[model samples]
Target: MQLDDLRQNWETFGAENPMWAIYTGRGRIEWDEGEFFATGDTEISEVMAVLERHGAPSGAARALDFGCGLGRLSQALAAHYETVDGVDISEPMIEGAKALARQPTGVDESRLRYHLNTKADLSIFEDESFDLVFSLITLQHMRPEFSRSYIAEFCRLVRPGGVVFFQLPTHRTTALKRLRGAAGRTMRKVRRSLLGGEPVMEMYGTPRKDVEALLTTGGLRVLDVLPDELAGPSWQSFRYLAIRPDSGD
Candidate 1:
């Protein structure tokens, strides 16, 4: 869909429906002031673990949460980073995020901000301004051509030793899984319907090799590619971590 159409769709969706509750799985009729949806606790915990394993810098690392829906992870990042900026393509998502940031919580509200835009073009933010950049279930939605640019932007936003991470559904694995079971087939049908005979920028299927190639071509070094359900049965997804090569590392 065109950017304007996508924006209008989200705006209408947000205006008529509470985006926060819908996107976060917080229930249709109720909203949870203390919990986050869209991304589950298990995924958040895994992200934190990966960040910690890589060694978060001491005392407030400037961080960026790309595709930060409803500011759930953005709010969490604020607690650890000196400043946390949440960026999303959907204006309603950013609106809900901004609202969440304003609530009186133990987190330092002064350190959080929201931007509405795509990751492929983050012209609003200066280069090398962040210590860490991350996104969850957001990259897969970007068009393949734009995905390359988004990875480049992620690299540009982080300082020379800064880390960047993102998750994408693996096309090959997902397809194989779909062929194995009724539930998987149902999921495949749902996904195909969502595409609706037109290229949905967000529904772009990215394979693991393609994503790794993009990162490598973008001048970032791969640190890891953790399988989504290494320990149990779950959707096939991959999380990638990479760092910008310093002048001399």
Candidate 2:
């Protein structure tokens, strides 16, 4: 699909169900700001623990949350890094993220900022700009070309000895299930055209080897490929952790 197609679907999602869109594919959440923000705390904490377990002990000075929805992770990430910038393709999502990024009275929200990104590649950033690059449950929504290009950008944006953590689907359905999904995609497209409701959000899978090669080309050393059941076992999700080679700062 074209970039605009992807953008349209997510923008529609953000406009209609900002909360549910961020935490996608799940059934309706009760939809309160308190619980919503709390989930962000939980996710960043879990990711921090995972990073520590993998041998990165120190925290980042600057971090980037790629495809960060509504600034949820960015708020939690600010505690780990001096500054955390969340970037997304949708304007509505970024607006929601900015609204939530505000701290209470006398508290500074400078550590967390959200930006709206329209480019497929992260050309907006300089080389080696971030100390940590992170994305979760986001890349799988884009086509492999977009994901692969962004993988390179993620690595390029991280400074030496920095980390790149991201997740993508590594498998696809086969046999009858594949047939059913193809039909479902067509139906969703038709419905979207006819009814003008929420656009059909499609998921794409990328091969593990292809990702590793992209990281290598992007000047990062492959660390580990952790299996994630976020999209369930049938979908085969995985998290990749890579580091730029250099002495720790």
Candidate 3:
């Protein structure tokens, strides 16, 4: 999808059902405020534990949560890092995140902040700005070209000795499944052009070898690749863990 179309699609999803768009398991029903954030806490905790075991994220100073829907992961990262930036392609998502952060039970404004970036790369931040560059299910929504650029940007955005972590599907398991995926894409395109209704959610993936090459080309050292079920049973997915060498930083 084009950048404009991606932003527009997320904007509609953000406005209509922000929580469910972030985590479809929540259903279209209203999400319990505490429960929603608690999941974030659990996820971030698990991520940190795994990274720590690998001696990643040389510092705990700052973190960047890309495609941070409503600042769920951003807020969770704040407990570990000194500062956290939550960035999304949708204005409504950023506004909703800011609103949630301002709540009494929400995170401290000084610790967590949100930004709306509709571009293909994260150039707004300086090089090596964050100690941890994190993304979860966010990258799967956009086209691979966009995702590839962001993966490279992650390498630049993270500090020397810091970690870059993300999850993405590799490919469909079977040829039939791949054909069906392509057909679904065509159908979605037709529906959008002809009907002009709500934006449909899209899924994309990168080959495992390409992802490794991207990280290496971006100067990151691959730490591990763990099989993940985040993309569901049909699609083959993996969580990437890589870190930048200190280089005497």
Candidate 3 weakest lDDT stretch, 10 residues: 25-34
lDDT tens digits, residue span 1-249, model 2:
678888888888888888987775556555777777777788788888888886653454888999988877777788788888889999888887877666451114677777888899888889998888999878988878899889988988998878899889877656575576568878877887888756767777888899999999988888888888766445777889999988653
lDDT of every model, 2 decimals: 0.68, 0.81, 0.89
Ranking by lDDT: 3, 2, 1
Which portions of model 3 miss their true places by more than 4 Å? 25-28, 58-60
**Candidate 3 C-alpha lDDT tens digits along 149-185:** 9999999998888889999999988899999999999
| Of candidates 2 and 1, the better by TM-score | 2
Q: Of models 1 and 2, which has the larger lDDT?
A: 2
Assess the local accuracy of residue 222 in candidate 3 as a C-alpha lDDT between 0 and 100. Answer: 93
Ranking 1 against 3 by TM-score, winner: 3
Judging by TM-score against the true structure, name the best candidate.
Answer: 3
For model 1, residues 89-176, the per-residue Cα lDDT tens digits are 7777788778766777535667888888843488889988888888876665545666667777887788888888887766544555
Candidate 2 to truth, TM? 0.91
